[model samples]
Target: MDYVDTFITVAEDCAAQTGVVPKPRGGRDTVAVLQHRMISAAPYRLTQGDVLFSTWLLQQGVDPATVPPEDPRRAEFFAVDRACLRASPLPKTHGWGLHFDAEGRVALVAVDDPRYADLHDSAGKVVKAMRSSRAR
Candidate 1:
């Protein structure tokens, strides 16, 4: 119920000026998909790095099955040091919030969801996604 650390949480109503949409394809929102993959994969869950790689692949309309480790394009995805999930459109452009487990894996929590309120008050450390509009 107390607070110290902070992260940005841009609600859906606030996104129009920036032109960021929750789910550009009109299906599952990006953060939700990330959460689903992380949860289902469990012991093999993706680190933030993997999620960033996969998210971009999905956005590009690639066939997921076609991407193997040896694929030439795989290198292109990792060229960046890491994908800052905190700055991802999923949370900044969508209502989703992010929480990291002890192992540093991520799962999404919606800003309006009850769990968001709980975590916001939790002793555990959690951060809202950052916004492009503001400097950190």
Candidate 2:
């Protein structure tokens, strides 16, 4: 079933712009991974991603017993903006596009996959994607 309050499909011919885009890695990739896990499993609002990602990072590669709540890095991960996913490498580096459902949950669609055409055009919106470079 297709729902239609917000017509926005993220897939497009980004080939020309792809070269200009930078691959997201390090911390950015970390944020993206967290977001992807949530979205792929179930649609989630951005706030959920922020809290979960912050919490999840602490458990990785460490013993929960010794980890301190006051670690400086905790604040950094906690500060990661959910908008970071919009500019994620999932589209530019990985050739996959993302779109939100009627419920405002994100899902990735392959940019080159013709089967995803149904998701390309948002009836009322012009559509937009993230730029790889910062505005400098």
lDDT of 1 by residue, 4-121 (tens): 2333344434353332334325565465455345434552245565566666677687655578857766676676565476666656665656565555565555566676677678
With candidate 1 superimposed using the best TM-score fit, by how many Å does residue 52's alpha carbon deviate from the native? 0.8
Give the residue spans of candidate 1 off by over 4 A.
1-21, 25-45, 66-76
TM-score for each prediction?
A: 0.57, 0.46
RMSD to the true structure for each prediction, in A, is 7.1, 7.8
**Which candidate number has the best lDDT?**
1
What is the per-residue lDDT of model 2 for residues 10-123, given as tens digits with 9 covering 90 to 100? 324345422222334664545445445545555434333333444366437543336466877656765775443445545544455555555544555555565346666543
Number of the predicted model whose TM-score against the real structure is largest: 1
**Whole-model lDDT, model 2:** 0.47
Provide the overall lDDT of each model, using Cα atoms, as 2-decimal numbers.
Answer: 0.55, 0.47
Error of 1 at 48 (Å): 1.7
